[model samples]
Target: MAQPRKMLLVDDNDESRYQLQTLLEFAGEKVVTRTCEKTITNIEDNLFALVINANSLGDYSLETITEKYPHTPIILVDSNKNHPLIQQQHDWRVIGSLALPLKYPDMMALIRKCESFKPEDLPSQTINSGNTEVLFKKLVGKTPEITKVRENILQLTDSDVNVLITGESGSGKEMVAKNIHYLSKRSNNKFVAVNCGAIPSELLESELFGHEKGAFTGAMTKRLGRFEVAQGGTLFLDEIGDMPLPMQVKLLRVLEDRTYERVGSNTPIKADVRVIAATHCNLRKAILEGRFREDLYYRLNVFPIEIPPLRARKEDIPLIVQNLLQTLEARHKKKIRLSSTALKALNDYDWPGNIRELSNLLERLTVEFSNQLIDAAEISQKLKQQGRITPSRIPEARLPEGDFDLKELLSNLEANYIKLALEESDGTVSRAAQRLGLGRTTLVEKMRKYQIDRDDISETDS
Candidate 1:
């Protein structure tokens, strides 16, 4: 068996340190306890898996630990989840922060997560020659609409002008923002995203500009906002049309001055970040109705990118499906192929929900038809169940015109049925065999023949 990973627990409070150390030992982890007064020189950073820093040590700030062990991951522990120190510290080395007294399960889970961390998992600044092509492929189409989107992204790379992306909901506006960020010089820094529609108006200011301790009710600690966190990087404001008029005025000021103050503090901070805003709603209509500010709209519309709805580019369905299936296969470790007729059935439909809806449907199909060739009949049945397609709109599944291998077709049918049985039986081999009316050993042999293993069945359990 492998050795237990060593973790460093630093806290000045003896009682709290003892409790955590005991818990870690009980959970089969090697714990090294240290008081805040200890010298940094005494500790070997590379020997420990992670550092659990609880409470602020006088002159020994979290930044001190981070600078000393630049490569090590640190988990901050505080009495308040929204502690000022937590917000102030934005170093990438800090994986997360937790409130104390700690819960056993949350602590253990975080420890396990840290143990799995690899240095290479951090985002790299390196971009290969095919970086543009690879980023465009994420948009997943060669149609004129998508090609123009790619070209627009390419144009925006050389400049730091604000971007306004208008698209239908689920049409990949955020993906476009991310592509622009990754392609720009700001790729190495944080790419902070905020959904303006989701945050309430009362809290939106603090969410964007952060707030000082006791700025408002229940504001026990100072917190850093999206703008501060996204310094020297890109800030993506999604669903900008939904922003309240009052907040829009404040945002417009920040845009014009390129500076903003915290919710309570009068100190002005320079906003060196690039802004990218996206909205599905028609901002011009909103402006006319006086629901959205016309001035803010003009300020954000410096460079606009309008994404074509999925229905407008039905010809790209086949390529999108192939891409989605490849992703699903990588995640589930089971390949799923669609027949020509199935592709036609998808192409025929109007995707009101765009790529997001298509991705959901593909995931559902993967669960129902793992390691199987999906036909038009199955696609139509699923779509009908989803209330997306009417009976009249269902396409007919036609057989191949040329001669086919009957044996291979029969084998595929058998494997699909066996896999379905295993799924319905909750991945129990014995239960699956009984459902298929076969001996357990015979069913196992067929699973081997079809290359279906315990790994595939276990994925279904998840």
Candidate 2:
């Protein structure tokens, strides 16, 4: 017989608490539910695990709990992104935050993580993976679109080609870049990523190319640049379109000559780094407008991989939810599951912010309504209250008040989003398609399928 698992779930939502009980029971674990108003003094020592909803525990002091139960591992389920206590702390070894819309896999992962550690070693950084780490976990789904992207990644991984990944701001571009580098021969080497748009132009040169001794006024000592440090590895240039014209010229030289002169140094240093540049901007248009360089664009566009947006890959939502939930549960130390209605609401909505937005919503759900099975009503209510969740903005179908065909509405929404995005982008099919996370060619095909006009759109090769 298996030992019964004891769990303590603290949250205010009645629905979440009950649903969480059912899920944990089904998982063959005994669960003990409580409200944040109840003190930790009530909890027995050596319980299976303790999961706290950070939102409800706002009034309750954390320092008190840490002092009282220093032996027990505590996981914090956080719904809100800006938690006062969470932001104030620097290193919280015991406290891991999970954003909501509860997920079962995430819960199990968290439990497993807790079980792997001893109470005496409670506040430690290293998490023991054991056999769990080797478990073949799929990060996302295998939609036809995603399958093709995966195939392309596999093909690109073995080669040392400089790749250009173009997509919308939050369309999982970095994840794709990391996959490519990890799968490639340069997996052993460092994968250094630099956000070209975020850094000031004045500071970007030194960041990419090492600064020499007395390189500038504040040049205290010689420091190796990102490129030199990432030697025999991959360098990810995010938001490349924002690079200044002067920086673009230097970047172009680096790409072509594979050598760069450090600041305050005449001698050129060899940089054997594979470049993977990403941008949300239309580089070709930027080049035409003289905002970006044409030569640099071609140099980085050797192997272009464009990630589809959340709207285009609706099929992947379920898988993404699962993956994200598992990640959250492990971090938050709570077990939460989603209801059919909740899943439908997710499917119906056109996620403008993409995967990042979905993850945020889930995190919120886990903290605000943990310990319950979350349905559509709860999801809508919570999202509405937060101002982050909006009703499905798809234009094609008139969704009546009563029960409707979710799958049909979703398909219509996807097609309509693509068609409208294309139209709004001045028929610049690529931009419109990119807005929908579709390839230029895919957008043209989708336009034809939806009986929309493709003639007015401009398709400049990237």
Candidate 3:
């Protein structure tokens, strides 16, 4: 039979330790109790799943335990939510944090999470050598830049470290995170994703750590927090740069100690969760400007991964388009194909919104155009009507007598047209090409010929 999971509980308080011991034993776990000053050497060689205690566990900080046993999860309990020692240690996988005294249900639930914990319970996928090759194929293109990203993913396979993904809004940051999770040892765990920007600050804490019945005026029932739900899994903090300062502090504490209290409860709970955070914003700048926490930045930056924008890797546009088209067609139950002219148009425009815009456009096209092969003219007409790109109005300045410089005017017009095409298509070259009377390849050539820098405008606005 498989051996029962063992848990080490370190606390100076007799009542708290005894209470926890009873609870753990009731849950069918083998509990080992030790005072803060007690030697932890016995745990060093055993397969203890978790270590639970306050920040001052006898004489050591949770970081000491984390350093000694990197793979074994540790949950820290602290009454002071804003403790600095706890904040600095927040980078690791902390499942929960609780205050003094304890609530039974929440604590028991946390223990259940730990007992049920398995690497496969997380939401990450598995990417083997063959899967990596498949992903490369699906991702498209063979640019040295893209090759480097793939290489980084490969390198991360052996380590279970926190990762911070940065990229433009639609540049597939989450996809990269999923690929990393699947490629790593945590592939079997659940992958719980959270949009830090989407949840209101007031709700963020509850959303992340959950709330007990009547925790707040509006909270009528018990709810499991993302951290608890994502136990033995990956918690993806999307748009992490947008998290509020207060929330950051709370989050920092959780990372430092591996424990958290629910919205209304004071009982300390422990969780065995992994975290993966992503954002398009420049966190360094945020830290300098007092927008993001410096300590938190360091914590999340342990494994930084930057996803290049679509324009930077234009070679992948065709492949991305192919993949997007297939996906859309499957979803919509259509067999639409892009004409050579349409395909060429798609290849030429600059994609500013990245993959997301491309995917959205494909969905729209499949829905509106159906099975008929889409042509450049029809595509261009549709884009113009949508106001994605507008033609440049004739400039009254330097009008020669009754006429204007046709060559100069045409150049201006072309520039305006490409700009309009870019905007109409949400900065996607392929979509812009389809919207313009050009092929994707032709659009690329024209962009090069026109000496246009798509990023200039993108940077100015974004």
Candidate 4:
């Protein structure tokens, strides 16, 4: 004879609560129904196997309940799982949502899913697979688009090849570069990151190659450039495409000659550090326009890695939300959850700001909606205010609602179709091409014409 599993059914609706309790009892499970927080809070540990909240359980916070009883399975019963408010609570890893007049088979499935739940199954989990640290876990994604990025990161470590990571602002170019430095043989040495665009053109040379005490009027003391500071390590040049034309010539010299001189010093310094550059601009286009050096472009583009935008890899949103929530919760000591509707809204909208924007939004939401469920409506409002989410991509069909030009409309429809295929196919160009009934080369050409990034299509070379 097996011992009966304890289940707590919470519902403010008396009739609904009684019905659920009776159903559980009829199903041969030991059941307890409670409507108040105090009642459930007082229940001893190792007592309940599951906690089911019907509709909204007033004060008995689901976040608190899940955290306090991590082992106990918590299910939020709702009419619609996609409800913005309901979807917000998925972060707690609820044992699936139960619909009204829930079926017995669904209950059994939840029980089985709960039993199989492991902490490591979450994207926020810190994993140790042999000696190599899984740094990309925090990057938090399982899609092939993101998985390919991880594969590239791993490959980057075995060699000291100069890497050029191209991605939109806030898409985590520097973070990826940081991971490369930490995972490299030069991990012990200094890892210096410089933003070429942020520094003025006049001071840019001094910043990269350093300056002697008498190099300039402001140079009262000897300064070590980023290259010298990063000796025997790695130097991350952010927004490298923004470097001035003259600086590009100097940079090209350093790359080819493996040496540089300080602003006032004639003696050249041997730069043993590895270079990893990143930019949001189209470097090839920049080269053609004479804004960026063509020679420097080839030197830095030796091993290119382009990060996919958040909208392009919407599959990564849930994992990213989970990972961000884990840290935000631990820091704030408050639980923040996103409803499935909210998640979908976030995933549906085009993220112009990428991961950095997503992270900032999560942080803001964490504080604003502390311990409260965030619905799709709130997410929509917030996204609108930030001008981060675009409504054009929301519809399942690729048709535009309000449009003037047939040519423009058709182009948008085609682009939307391609975007959907790439997303559905997990950014694999070949797979997306197959789905679109186009040759791989033809799709690649179209993507180029449309200015669709390779990462947005798929990180794979295919």
What is candidate 1's local distance difference test score?
A: 0.76
**Judged by lDDT relative to the true structure, which candidate is superior, 2 or 3?**
2
Candidate 2 lDDT over residue span 130-210, tens digit each: 321111113366677666666667677459988999887567777777767766667646789887754657888999998
lDDT of 1 at 96: 61
Off by over 4 Å in 3: 1-138, 385-462
lDDT digits (tens) for residues 227-300 of candidate 1: 99999999999878778789999999999999999999999999999999998878999888998999888899
- lDDT (Cα) of model 3: 0.69
Q: Whose lDDT is greatest here? A: 1
lDDT of each: 0.76, 0.70, 0.69, 0.72
Q: Is candidate 1 or candidate 2 better by lDDT?
A: 1
Candidate 3's residue-wise lDDT over 315-370, tens digit each? Answer: 87777777667656545678578888987776665665677766656667888888
lDDT of 4 by residue, 1-462 (tens): 865557767677788778878877887777777665754566644444555554555655665665656646566676676754355433435545677778888877676666665543333533343553354435567777777777788787669999999887667788778767766667646779887754657889999999999898989999999999999999999878768798898999999999999999999899999999988789889888888887788899889898988888888888888877786676677777788899888888777767766766777788888899998998888776555223554547654577569887779868877776665443546556767899777987888878776454322110
Q: List the candidate 2 regions with Cα displacement exceeding 4 Å.
A: 1-139, 385-462
Q: In candidate 3, where is summed lDDT lowest over 10 consecutive residues?
A: 118-127
Candidate ranking under TM-score, highest first, comes to 1, 4, 3, 2
Model 1, TM vs. native: 0.58
The residue pairs found clashing in candidate 4 are: 84-375, 84-376, 87-338, 87-339, 87-340, 88-338, 88-339
Q: Count steric clashes of candidate 4.
A: 7
